[model samples]
Target chain A: MKRILIGALFALPALTAMAGDFTASLSIAPEWRTDNRDSAYFVAPPVVPVQHRSARQDLGLRFRDGGFNAQGTLRVLAREGQTPEQHGIVNQFYYDGDLGNGSGYTFGRKVISWGVGFGFRPLDVIQREDRRSLNPPPLTGVPLAAWEHFSADKAFTLVWTHPGHRHEATDFRDQSLAARYYRLVDGNDIHAVARLSGRHALEAGAGITHTSGEEWAFHAAALYQQRYSKTFNTLAESGGGILAAANPMQEVMRRNGLKAVLGSQWTGTSGFGVLVEAWYDAEGYSRNEWRRLDALTARQRSLNGMAPASAINGNVAWSSRAFERPNLLRENLLLRLSHDDERWKPALELLVTPRDGGRVITTRLEYQSDRQRVSFGLRFLGGAADSAYAQAPIKRMAYFEWRLALL
Target chain B: MFKNALALFASLLATLIALPALAADDIAALLKRADGYRLLEESVRIETLVESYRGDTLDKERRYTVYIKPGRRSLVLMKSPAEAGQKVLMLGDQFWLLMPDTQRPLRITATQKLLGDASTGDIANMTWSDDYDGKVVDEVDIKGRRCLHLDLSAARPGVTYARIGLYLDKASKLPIKADLYVHSGKRAKEAWYEAKTVDGQLRVMSMTLLDDIQAGRRTVVRYQSIVALAAPDEFFNPAALVRNTLAGW
Candidate 1:
């Protein structure tokens, strides 16, 4: 028995030697906020004077080696609000392994494919807001306490690549494939995606996204990208969205349809370039359906008894880095201009109704220092819109915003 | 005549013994010569193609007219997407960014590390000159290519990685591979360089980084082109880091 105990002790060193590399860091940020508006629900409510503060702490740990890697992160937010104190925790874990040759396996709570154009949204968290019927509540305080809940959305992504391999020689040869599967904890939703792409000087690929749940949807897109010159290139994509589930709202409004987008960017010069995007939504009534649903479901209605029933919006922006400095720092100054339009039909029991259309100009300056970044910007809103709770119409407002990182 | 012959044989034997030592010393000198260009000033144009595991690929290509003056300063200026100008400047130990729209420069922390090849080493830290004193350990062949092996140890605390083993190409006298160990006695991370000659100079055209512990995941950085740069002294000034022209770069 003593000899056996000695043998077990000897194995401990071998086990410890196999333990690989690890790194970890912790960050805490506490913020103080003063807002003129009481809450997100109050549209132009008399600017209230209020002070609030919150702190968020984040921790990340990583362990990696030749065969596998494991990473985890935890984030906690604690807030002192006017209504009640609130705190929340979020955790994520990821594990991946090499299948050999240019393929790999990954399991985690990660971003999955299920969108059109540049607007692909990941499935992770869902937020719901509470509303009242009558004069809208002030824009301050916690919006919805009961609606906050954690959802388990886990996914697996299988990735393979030939031309995109890290080695330059391997990238010169083409062969790659990627597949993804995702499901929500409630078993209410499932998403599947598959993509096969490569570079043979001229690159082209196609993908399909299928989603089924309480609300079923399907999306298919094809992309073509080509490098024309040393400084010039182009990419084009086309896709369609379909609702497969039957809904009384969809039948009443004929709202199920397709959305498409086309965009391009050019980088021929030293400090100046342009990106232009154009989009079209074929189902016009979809906007009206959403607005009507929002109005009907609002827990609290504004005093003026106005509720928006339908709206449509379009916008454009331009950015440039004409002024720049050379050093370890990379900075760019950008200016943007945009315009939007919306039409609101009041709920049946309301008094005033009007179509709101307006133009907005936003200018922002951003600076990035290594991993740290900061941005400050000003926005001017000019438009005519209907008010939900107030008898008076909403007017234009302007404000400046700033964001910073502590570490 | 017998005594004379004995002395001659002894001299020949000594010469034979010293030949290997002389070759080893020559190789070490060659490696030192290769490490001589401590500072490099250049501009880079990069095109990135990101392929997602889900089979989707994104092409984000950018051009930067940059100035990298070793240990002292680095600057980057962007020239496309014409709405705002952005610049980043690093002077000495302090870093700053300038925004054209707001015209403000913000300070940055040194602990912030970018997720790229440059982040793996204190290549930008002048203190690296004192971090690890390097010595030629031995001569070995890597993948059939003869190389001079160098072992480096930390001379001070906070030197990023703890130990580094470099395998330098004997023919070109340039570093071909590096095994970097971090966190004071942990395992190492390996990086391999594929070099090409451009404009009469040997430069790392492409590099591959592999986690020594993790099997299949690696990152590759390819240098599309590099141009020699002549930068103004003010470019490295910390005060200029936040200027609209400097920040927007």
Candidate 2:
């Protein structure tokens, strides 16, 4: 795969010379992380070592000729205390062929995202993008074949994802068949999607977006899954055992899961904008589940002198894995304010979990020129001493990235 | 003889009363003629180049391909390296923007649509007869050329400008200059049109916009080429925006 990606990169210049639209860019990003030393999970010996800083450099290219399109990235990564590594990513490689009467077919890897909402898109069953991630990289397309038909105001699409692959451990890798229907009526956009898979059986969703007057836009989306899965610590759920020798976390499957999001945005003519969104995920941990896990960790911490430090630290580290989930709680609210003034864009975002009074605040700024763009941001995890964000092992993170277009 | 005189007086009064209506028709005809200098056909494919300058020095440049259809439908595709694969679809009063990274069509309001330096409306909308209506206000001389000044108000709610003061060449009825007013009735920008003979027809090939709020900033929009093309209706659909490659078109 690496060899193929390198070869493709080498061919981009030749492709450009031979009658095609080609684009290339170079970017450098460095990220810094701060750890919370006061957290109960933080032990003197350190159960899990953490890296304080990392940097990445990327050379990306994209080409489009007729119905053929390809995009790839060559990356060099370095960490605070590790050797530099190099790799390549084939972000997208697809061929689109047009059929008669407003129909088309796509073969190979492509990015197909259909949803409505900025914070959480319940209808995005295929990509399942994590919207809250900080300083994310370019998305990689999934392997699939799709057929589509379109009209003046309506469209229908059917896709087969991960063709020839069996059910995988993760939902994204699972083999599935998905379809979407979209329509525009009286200034309202309506969308519906359904997916069939072996693990989840079936998932269906619908969404709508509407704009009123000249400044406001409203969107709502909801998805229902026949089955969903979550990982939980067995010790906490059983109400027993202060410490365990091995990891006690295990995955559990449940029936009837739903995810929903409602949001609205208002933009003024002066370039200031505000967005408010709230979402609920059945797969996320509930209030009682967090309380149980918190109680388990507290009970384990009480045995400081009685038990070995490694045992307690190990158990706490295992429990801390709960924070890795996209949403720490089942319910979340997001508020973002931004200003776009032609060349500069600045934004502030706040994510709150109403159940535990937890919140994450982020500030971002970007300056765009004709051929270069610079972006930087800072994020702090805190709010309420007992909140999940406050108790997490990581406290704050900052990052800066500069990008230049070469072609 | 007395009755005949009374009938003739009534006829004269009616013509006097209908004079304003006749003038309105003339105004509409003039606007249509001015529109022809910008849009030669009901549907066209235009290649546009936009350059932003600060004090006569070029600061930024971008390119776009615009497709305009009847019934107020248009699509703008960004071709600049900074915004490659970005598309904006406009249908009547509604708009949707599709970014290259997300591959999702996001709905945007009229105010949000006017955020960029060269707004989507500036690149896509070429005809004024469909979005504005008014009467001729006066005939004046600008730069030694006789011109007719028209005061026009938005007939459609989705227009980027709420009102406009337009000047057209009195003889050719070609658009010469316009003062754009926002919803607050404040002059936002001043636009001057430049026409050139292309393929034996006079067409507005470039437009220069002077910023009213921010002094010393100017934007020039140049049409590299324009040809008659009725793009398939499906390309105008918001949902179909992601699917249409438009490779050959």
Candidate 3:
């Protein structure tokens, strides 16, 4: 940690030429929802569930000079019936300096993307993501040290990352490392990457992308992970006599797993883009397994008053590592269509878990007004009552966000 | 006399049809020369003002500063209007767009539209000799200005357009007009280039792009204060894209 801290101090130059270029932005969004998931757990069920509302505020600042740049964000969150919480996050703090001879390194917290897929990148094995918002933020970055060297036709990269706030590393020798090699072949960008991390897990992936003609853009990526989790189920504390004793989060087994993504984008002269992606996650549950989760959720909902007495009933709520969780199914498909222009953008996104028939639809409209942006969006989730998305407490919601960038 | 006159007419017709085939050797050279006149220097800085209009209404007006190393790299920084802090960086074939508030630059496709009528390809690429093969097809006069009509095709994949039709000034060999087409030969857009003498060298002053798919929609970009200045590679990097002081407006 001290070495990384010293590295940051080295990025600041004598004159600080870019200090005057600093800029700041503020965003305020108030949300209203029809089905409030918070009420399903935090509040007691009665004649009427409280209307769910929240006010979210965010502030951002950035500064860059020469090869040094720093950026951070602050969030002020308040629920309708809860006290406000303030959190600070650093998005990127790094220096991109050349080390002579075509080799360079970016040492700090930065997002290093590897895969070619749009919505779901199988090779984007970054360890963190925030699923709390309507549109879950992109992956959270890690403290990293990277070395890269490349020429016109070929390149190589190595990255080392620290867990930061994560304490799961079993030993002091827990160092995460990844390496990638990329080459341009017949107008196609092809790359392969391998990663070594905690718990003796090994991961490798490869991807290809091309946009030869203006008509369409094509990409495909496949990743394989060793010792992957098959399920997050385990035994639980006993509460419902002798019938409901096993209800806890436990790894059933570990084995090799594969994930693949295939996608394409169609570009039109009218400035409209249609993107389609098909994703497969072998670590996810099958249709039959989703049925079990659905049954459990239904059982929990039925036992509303008696839920506290039965640990099995409580298992349904304890499953999610975080809220607004991703669809847990074997296969999924995504279709998105949007207009690309300067000021106003309108878009529609549809995601489907084909094997379980679960679906999510989102419609959004955004307006950019010099230094400020405002957006309104609505989301709907549906499927068989027992499916993943349908079993979730929330069914429909709408949100708006307004932002101003003051430089 | 009639037979002799018939032979002359036949010879002229043959030359008209055979001109493009005979000029193949000069095609590559002419394309390279045209590119050189625009690229002028290995590294350059250009200030641009873009105005877009749809039908009878002005849709948008924006300004930007572009730092370019010809075919190697380019950094486009938004200067005025609502998106002042936005920036775009292009290196080799990779493209990244950085918004003022976004965590990092997100990868973008070259075919995506940049403004009203300019695509990412049009902004990312400043040279054509490396990506296109040109062949002079016909010599004609457009409103008293002698022009050479050239047919250009993509020499490699990943290019923004598969085919282009260019009209160059016969006297200076500078580009006057161009039409881009898709793989199936469908016209996508038309451009008119304007050039003027800057620092004793002919340089493109402004470009007007007209949408072929949508009638009555066009964008005009005028270049200002173009200078030959060397910018470090870090100036064109992804991190530098967010540097608000790159050009200092």
The TM-score values for the models, in the order shown, are 0.33, 0.94, 0.78
Q: Assess the local accuracy of residue A360 in candidate 2 as a C-alpha lDDT between 0 and 100.
A: 96
Candidate 2 on A1-407: residue-level lDDT in tens?
Answer: 44654675577667678777888888899999898888765544346866789998888888788889888888888887778788788899999889989899999888888978988888988888887788888888899999999999899999999998895678878899999999988899999999998878899999999998889999999999998888899999998778998999888888999999999999989999999999999988998998888899999999989999788888988898898888888999999999989679999999999998999999999998878999999999998888788888889999999999877
Per-candidate local distance difference test: 0.35, 0.88, 0.67
lDDT of 1: 0.35
Ranking by TM-score: 2, 3, 1
Q: DockQ each candidate and list the results.
A: 0.02, 0.66, 0.25
Per-residue error (Å), model 3, residue B226: 4.5
Give the per-residue lDDT digits (tens) of candidate 1, residues A133-198: 112111111111110111123334444433234342222233435444443322222444444433
Give the TM-score of chain A, superposed on the true chain A, for all candidates in the order listed: 0.38, 0.95, 0.82
Residue A389 accuracy (lDDT) in model 3: 68
Model 3: per-residue lDDT, tens digit, A120-235? Answer: 76776654232224644323456788888755556677888774534433322345788877776765668798888764379899988866445577889998887555544442
Enumerate residue pairs that collide in model 3: A212-B158, A233-A250, A234-A250, A235-A248, A236-A247, A370-B82, A371-B82
User: Which of 1 and 3 is the better model by lDDT?
Assistant: 3
A117 in model 3: Cα distance from truth in Å?
Answer: 1.7
